[model samples]
Target: MTRELTPKGSATRQRIIEGAAAEIREHGVAATTLDDVRTRTGTSKSQLFHYFPGGREELLLAVARYEAGRVLSDQQPQLSRLTSWRAWEEWRDVLIQRYRRQAWDCPLDAVVSQLGRSTPGAQAVLTELLNRWQGEIAAGVRAMQEQGEIDPGLDAGQAAAALLAGIQGGVVIMLSTGRLTHLEAALDVAIQHLRESRDRHPADH
Candidate 1:
């Protein structure tokens, strides 16, 4: 069931989640506790329970959603302003730099993995974030197509999906190897393919 909150209640809930995130970032999800969140956020136990009626799991899910939002936020306005080739290149560098700075430490993933992606709230947050992100990318590709910057024949949906898949795969590899090779290779191949595909259209030159 969805929990409804008043304006003040909503603010308090957000405070707890933000505090929880900070605690998790410092000591990880396994080590963060309800008391820590309460103390950190300056919220009382009753106040905490008022917002998180379902308790720790529910709070973690909310934080999961918040962190998922960050994943996309970190990529903007570069992602949002991809109307030209230069914008795409700039966005690519931003993407690479963001992940490079976050190596070996996916705190959000740590929490979600513990919560189980199969959980309804967790799954919904991820699905929405990914779909929205991919849609933005697809829109950018379409905009470039309309500007005659890329091949009009290019499938925007497929290209965007491929890009998102590559990003996810790259992140997984980075998590496993503590390096950016996978991400760099994925972006390099995808971008190279895009450039080559554009070249294939005679009028694209």
Candidate 2:
């Protein structure tokens, strides 16, 4: 069973996680080690084990959760408010800019790659992140539908799924090729489809 931590213990654990995450971000997972985290966090072997008794895998899982949270947090209030065409455009720009800046390294991707998707902890973290992101996108689509800004008959869930898939593909390509063309195109085309629906349903507006 996990032991409940005092406030000081909680802070210490968080410090280790943050320091480990930073080490992973800079050195890649294979290059990072417990010793590295220990040095970076100014913690001893006993202290590290105190919080993460399961050892490296457990600590890695913790870092994976942290990085996944960062992915959504980075998108911020923009992602939360995709209610209008203007708002969607702003969200899209934020997505593009955020990924572009992160082109040097994507911490979540690195951690997931290290842990392997089949790992239960990694899969759970990814599933939660994607589901939450898709849910927000669906909510935005529904808002647009309610506003009569798009086809009322359109499936918000399906549209959001496709858009999200396109985005993931575009990011993968961008990461591989060091170019943002695919990402921009995917977002542009997805948004264009919504705008076209709006045009077709102008009478509904």
**Against the unseen true structure, what C-alpha lDDT does each candidate score?**
0.87, 0.91
Task: Encode model 1's per-residue lDDT on 94-144: one tens digit a residue.
Answer: 999999999998877888897997988778988998999999899988888
Error of 1 at 199 (Å): 1.8
Error of model 1, residue 50, in angstroms = 0.5
lDDT of 1: 0.87
Report, for all candidates in order, the number of backbone clashes: 0, 0
Compared to the true structure, candidate 2 yields what TM-score?
0.94
lDDT of 1 at 64: 89
In Å, residue 180's CA in model 2 sits off its true spot by 1.1
- Cα miss at 166, model 1 (Å)? 0.6
